[model samples]
Target: MALKPHRSPRRVNLISPADRIRPDAASVLLKMVEEPPPDLSFIMIAEDLDAILPTLRSRCVLLHARKPDPEAAASWLEAKGLKDFDEQLAEAGGNPLAVIRGHKIVPDEARALFLGLLKTGKRLDITKVAPGVGTGWKLDACADFFSRWGTDLIRVKSGLQPSYFVGETPELQSIAPGADLQRLFHWLDETESLKRASSVPLNNKLALEKILESYRSVFRS
Candidate 1:
């Protein structure tokens, strides 16, 4: 597809978070990047430029973007009807696009409940999970947070400091003893998969619940 011809207008290929491209996939694209078709243009976006492959980095011209002002970004999201994004905005490091990516799958109250459940470790009762815990709410954001939380659990269990979910050291410590190391890795993989497919969840609530089941299993082992 990279070598395909465009009749009239140029075809633009936009890849967000390009750093996540698998090594094999990046290898496949390396040739096309070196000699791209005249009709095609690829714009790769990444939050961390250093994570990009050296081969790709050497060939492409880098452009750094300024971080958006937190207050202004928050105002814009609120204006766009993404209310109570203070937590999301802060977590996103002032990236408005990241904050908006969730599309408001759930409200703040449900967010609180979901995190509360995670803090329960082995005691997380799926049966008592709130209705809005999944639904159509902030899916990308939810998956991101869920992924980070599981990672933190792994770190705590491995006797390391929390990398992403800071300020949760106490809760992570409480949950660490019950974590099965191998299961935590598996759970993290599933969470990352959920985040990738979060854009089009056929059954939004079910998707989140299924991942939550994996999370609950991490403690059981």
Candidate 2:
């Protein structure tokens, strides 16, 4: 058996995004937050409150940042000399900073690829689509894509409009009938866990394979 290395605890200021901190780290951080050294302080930021660990969230004073209005965001983008400002604003979900920083919140290609795979139904093959679910940030983006796709499917099944893929309602409708609701919702839960765990180093290939396999199971007809 290998011996476990000892770690020396040190005092330092922590400036981290609440969402990015993993569960294990959060537990350790919680103790610090509950009682920190006089010289140390913590500043945590997070866009999604639900993504933050509940224990950590409860300890901090919450500050809500309202998203900008779409029209205002578009105007800001235009003032910055960005063409197709409306499209960019929509793609960024009206987050002006995201548009300004050139972050593509909506992965169009990944969404299309996932929808196509969903359309395959029982014939879906995890190996063939594994490349699309690339490693690291790309894999995280794929999980985001699948989460939205699954939400849209659920919405369509409930006789509601597909929020993420409005134009692809017909395709959503096609797959909704065959989708295993329980499995799909379970997969959504798993993807949320995956997204929360994304900040840490992970086995990307194995993770993607498992996700794709779950996707395959969701469409068992």
Candidate 3:
């Protein structure tokens, strides 16, 4: 496609060096970059600089893109007045992009699901699981929290302290009665496997229900 004509006096031509340019074509393109047409400029967009020819890099100006701050992001979210504030932030998994998108997912619902899982421990009942308890809503939350919870349960079984969860710390501490780490590990592995497999089946809801039930069995065992 021909480059869009910009209103600016300096012309900007966007090109990809990756394109298979004939030697003559490359010479011509290089000439354009070296000595741009009158009131014309060249802009090359590259996915990575390392891939570009040294000749091209020598003539181009490098610009660095900066990401937004998480603290500032959290503050912005707070100012927007989202209910279940902490849960929204936690669901973000420390990514500012996720925090910006937290409003799309129901924070209260996701939090309740996570908390419910923690509260039940080994005795958690899958049949009575609350809504939105299934689906791989937040892999980080499940993997990180549940994995740690399992470790804590193992620690508790050994007469040691099972530290707390970020929001569910108190609840975890309260329910810290002896845990079976080995069983917990097995359950986590099973749940993770099922969760991953949920993608294969079209009936995602049924798959999730089976996953929850499977988890319940692991806990019961």
Candidate 4:
């Protein structure tokens, strides 16, 4: 019956069933649903609506959010031309909002460095790579790229999809058939976790070297 904002300041009044329900508390929540407030509208959001009471469902005016226009989504995919589009979408939990936020958060310099590394045949010195890959914003940028690259490689190995940032490197493709993509994924996970727990350590050079070395080893094998 009462309304309030989701966040602080309470500028908007929104109500949800999840906020008021409790175990062992005898309350007629159904009544509130049955007779909503006058001069106000009620909106119910659920991933699965089968659990709601039949009477409540019957009385409710169901309004479903329309799916994104296929042509618009296709235009977006065409713009990126990413081989791992599905993977990125998956990482963003299939939510278009999350995908946009994720892309927006990517650092421009970090992206440039990634392209540079790939072009150098994985031969770029750690000294040169450090400035581009160092821990900034709590090592977030580096960790995100690392994870995304690893995921792309894993997808390639599984024969499910191509990689977004990956290219047809003769050297890489020659050895990729014999490479251990799973091992690389595990190492990426370990490095990401370490970077997160280290409180932005001073040895970013060492971290960059380890990451590149591990990646080079994948193609070398």
Candidate 5:
């Protein structure tokens, strides 16, 4: 008789950002999910469902959560005593929970350092950025910032106001002239790829260095 591993009466395996799961990890998870114990349940959440593995996605019942009302969400955050979240709230496209998650996950200092580097353009020192947002989930945060900032650069170049970082219009205007629009667009794609990959275990400093290298390259003549 095989030895049985002890488990509770009910078990749930939760995977958020399901699309970021490594292929090998997904294969192992697939096995358990395929023939999971009756008491086991898997709940997966993803920002982009199509990016998740089809086999795994097919096994679960899908449900979509509606976006919360922005005004209500802002009120809730205010009631919780959170101020200075208006930027994150707008950045999240009015998704209140995302604003809260971002606030808790990243430090304010790291955010300031990143934006300062963005304004530095070709002079951006990678050493300064490495410590600010190079570890663990901070890497993901930095990647998200760069990806969105790249979009704002596009808006500025096109004579439209930025959606995020409306407060940084002067800085964006200063940097936009130096950046090639085509390269900025390409950098956006690269930043997104890096953000998705940041979830995996890797050298945090090296990853930030690589991403910031591409950021400098966008301004190449």
Candidate 6:
């Protein structure tokens, strides 16, 4: 697509967030940034500067962004008239914008369902959780939840603090003892891959079933 023509004499600001631009898009953007029109300015934001293409990074000034403190982020959310600010802030990993926009998927129902699956251990019925594996943001969120659950299981096994579900230590402790680390790590890797592939059109139900079934295998009798 040709760059949208900007009328002369009017200042234009082009802002691109990190990870949203593919390599081809970055190439096109590089040309514009290299020889920007007199009235045009570009601002590119990235969570990891190193992840940005070297060609793109070379053409612009770099700025590092720091995540806000959880307490401060919670306070800001509360000031914005949001309830459960602390929980939201933690769910967002202290990202101020995520907290403000409330983009993180609410995991209450999913967590409850997952906890039941964990309680069943080796006999978990993947079919039960399969129906809840929705597409779009919900599927992405479900994959993330599993990843965090995997992390918490590892933490419990290794005698460390659980970052996601701190209140579920007892349950985590019970499950952690029989968790096969090799299988758990494999499942974690698979969840991450699914998360990255979420943008593409997928059979969300089948994908979710595969993930849950794999998760069921992580626990040994």
Please name the candidate that would achieve the greatest lDDT relative to the true structure. Answer: 5
- TM-score of predicted structure 5: 0.75
Residues 1-221 of candidate 1: C-alpha lDDT, one tens digit per residue:
54455575788788887976766778878888998878788899986575577999898888888976767887788889888776566556556786778643347676577778899887887876647554446666677778777777887888997765566689899889988889889887787677657545357667777878778888864
Model 5 RMSD, rounded to 1 decimal: 4.0
The C-alpha local distance difference test score for the whole of candidate 1 amounts to: 0.74
lDDT of 2 by residue, 1-221 (tens): 12232553434454555676667878998898898765455678776678777988898887777887767777777888888655455445567787778777436665555667766765777776657653334655666766877788898988997756566678889778888889889989888877766666777767766776787788767
Tell me each candidate's TM-score: 0.59, 0.72, 0.44, 0.48, 0.75, 0.71
Ordered from best to worst TM-score, the candidate numbers read 5, 2, 6, 1, 4, 3
lDDT of 6 by residue, 85-168 (tens): 655555555676886765765456666777678666678897787676433436666777778878888988898877666667
lDDT for position 84 in model 3: 52
Clashing pairs in 6: none
- Pairs of colliding residues, candidate 2: none
Off by over 4 Å in 1: 1-40, 47-90, 93-107
Model 5 worst lDDT run, 10 consecutive residues: 1-10
- The lDDT for every candidate, in the order shown, is 0.74, 0.71, 0.54, 0.53, 0.78, 0.72
* Candidate 4: 10-residue stretch with minimal lDDT: 18-27
Model 3, 16-89: lDDT tens digits are 64332334555667767787767676667543365455676688788754544656667776777755555445
Better of 4 and 6 by TM-score: 6
For 28-81, candidate 4 gives per-residue lDDT tens digits of 545665664554455655432543555556766777665455346545765865
Candidate 2 to truth, TM: 0.72
Ranking by lDDT: 5, 1, 6, 2, 3, 4
Measured over all alpha carbons after superposition, the RMSD of each candidate to the real structure, in angstroms, is 6.7, 7.0, 11.2, 10.6, 4.0, 4.0
